[model samples]
Target: MERDKGKLELIATQRVNANSEMYKVVDFLNKSLKNYHLMFGLTKKDESMVISIYEVE
Candidate 1:
């Protein structure tokens, strides 16, 4: 941990276009990864969906 917090390291990222159902996938991944000290994040960039995976420890 850095500064008393677990450092988040980016493991993967992808940008998908024309997919409206991607939130469901991110939700599922978040649920599944919670117990493993991992996180799934999503962002809206222009017309694309940006997804990322981070390790919490």
Candidate 2:
């Protein structure tokens, strides 16, 4: 995760077959932190999954 000013970027890697709980967590955090959470992408490579997120004021 990286933070700059009022923006935050998060890159989370997991198993491709695993449940994607990040979506819910992101939603919760957005409300909790009073910030907007934008989903960048979800990429899959072999057995690995990548979740990209951005939080902005």
Candidate 3:
């Protein structure tokens, strides 16, 4: 039905937006890592606290 088609289109558009946001986040992280000579690793204290070290160049 036309209603189903509309729902599918909305879902597709949402997926596209999510993918675009993911790409932007990845790009930003990559640029920051490169610009700062940064190193990142998982911390033992907690799973969420990722440790990132950067040295001034």
Identify the runs in model 1 with alpha carbons over 4 angstroms from their true place: 1-3
TM-score of every model? 0.75, 0.32, 0.28
Candidates in descending TM-score order = 1, 2, 3
Lowest lDDT 10-residue stretch of candidate 1? 1-10
Candidate 2 segments whose C-alpha is farther than 4 A from its true place:
1-18, 35-57
TM-score winner between 2 and 3, please give it.
Answer: 2
State the local distance difference test value for candidate 2. Answer: 0.54
Candidate 1: deviation at residue 37, Å? 1.7
Steric clashes per prediction: 0, 0, 0
Model 2 lDDT tens row, 22-55: 5566456656655335434456566566665554
**lDDT of model 1, residue 12:** 94
Per residue, candidate 1 scores C-alpha lDDT tens digits across 14-43 of 888947788898899889878898999899
Candidate 3 local lDDT, 1-57, one digit each (tens): 234321211111111222324445545665767555443322333223333333333
Rank ordering of all candidates by lDDT, starting from the highest: 1, 2, 3
Q: 1 or 2: which has the higher TM-score?
A: 1
